[model samples]
Target: MELAIGIILGCCALGAGICMGIGAIGPGIGEGNAVSKACEAIGRQPESKGAVTSTMIMGCAISETTGIYSLVIAILLIFVAPNILVNVLLKAIGLM
Candidate 1:
């Protein structure tokens, strides 16, 4: 029983770490690309800097949602999944 609980908690921690690590990669790359392109656009058309900047900001915010979602899921896995999994394990072994 102790082993099982330890495994469950360990797996949850591992999963959360993996989830955040992978999830952050996309947004980091995307935001970098978006900012680069936005800078080029502003350079090409200084008069349209306001519009381009606003659009870039909006797009970056939208792109960041995926990372935020992963963060939420990671939080759930670290804080919530282990308890639920342990309860299920206990029930399966007829101990609960």
Candidate 2:
């Protein structure tokens, strides 16, 4: 029983770690690309810096949502999933 709970918790931690790791990669790359492009645009059209900056900010913010979602899911997996899973396991085994 204890072993089962330990395994459940360990798995949850591992899953959360993996989720965050994979989730961060996309946004990191996307944001880097967006910023790079934005810099290039501003360099090409210095007069339109205001517009380019605003658009870049919006794009970066939108792209960052994916990473934020992954963070939320990871947090849930780490802090919430283990307890819920443990409870379900206990109930299924008639211990809860």
lDDT per model vs. reference: 0.97, 0.96
Q: Lowest-scoring 10 consecutive residues by lDDT in candidate 2?
A: 78-87
Task: Give lDDT: candidate 1, residue 9.
Answer: 96
Question: Which pairs of residues clash in candidate 1, taking residues 3 or more apart in a chain or in different chains?
Answer: none
lDDT of 1 by residue, 18-94 (tens): 99999999999999999999999999999999999999999999999999999999999999999899999999999
How much is the lDDT of residue 59 in candidate 2? 96
List TM-score per model, in order: 0.92, 0.93
Total clashes in model 2, counting residue pairs 3 or more apart in sequence or in different chains: 0
Off by over 4 Å in 2: none
- Residue-level lDDT of model 2, residues 26-80, one tens digit each, is 9999999999999999999899999999999999999999999999999999999
